[model samples]
Target: MKAVLVGILVGLATASPVSLHRDPWDPTIKLPSPTQQLVWGDVNVLHTTDIHGWISGHSKDVYPEKSWSGNFGDFYSFVTHMRQKAMTKKSDLLLIDTGDRRIGHGLTDHIFDPKKANGQDA
Candidate 1:
């Protein structure tokens, strides 16, 4: 019982809450005016490349690859939310994409059946 109580107390002290709030009029906390701040002094950049059709995630269900299969739609939503958060915190944020943009998939290939020769009989 004593050990469990100690563990609970330790966890509570070390845990960080998801959100924090400060009193707006607190004299010690001076909000910086726009003119006094450097707009891009400290910036954060995110880059993704060679993504291919991975927007739907890799098909293989193994370890790290399995973990990433969460899909591109989730990633886009995450980025949108994070950018909004960065803007709220008055920080510079940039996202970049690079490399080949082609999508290779059965859906794309089947658009024109290969069995038909020269748009005529197979």
Candidate 2:
């Protein structure tokens, strides 16, 4: 776990970032590609956290906001590819998501009327 985190940090630190999506609504931003090739072991973990209800991801063309343009479908595609890679390598891959379901963002917070099932309608 520690090694994976370190690898990601190093990748982020050394690589020139880029954006993956080219949606009309999303701002043009470069996606990040790791400078160093990531090492895969017999067992691997792919983790995601926070999210803060950014299912559609950041649409604004601002600095940090534009970076996370890939949405849930993109995330699913990535996981699928990773799973296929792990299968070919005969390794175990696990995906974990720490909580924080619906907290921020207008999609989750403001789209639904609170009076309707305490936002369960969302």
In the order shown, what is each candidate's alpha-carbon RMSD? 14.9, 15.4
Tens-digit lDDT track of model 2 for 1-122 = 99999999999999996766354434464556889987999999999876765677777886556666878889899999999999999999999876343444333446655355244555
Best by lDDT: 2
Report the Cα lDDT for candidate 1.
0.65
Over 76-101, each residue of candidate 1 has an lDDT whose tens digit, in order, gives 88889868877887887888765332
- Tell me how far the alpha carbon of residue 36 in candidate 2 is from the true structure, in angstroms, after superposition: 3.0
C-alpha lDDT score of every prediction, in listed order: 0.65, 0.74
Q: Alpha carbon lDDT of residue 105, candidate 2?
A: 39
TM-scores for all candidates: the values are: 0.45, 0.55
Q: Clashes in model 1: which pairs? A: none
lDDT of 1 at 17: 87
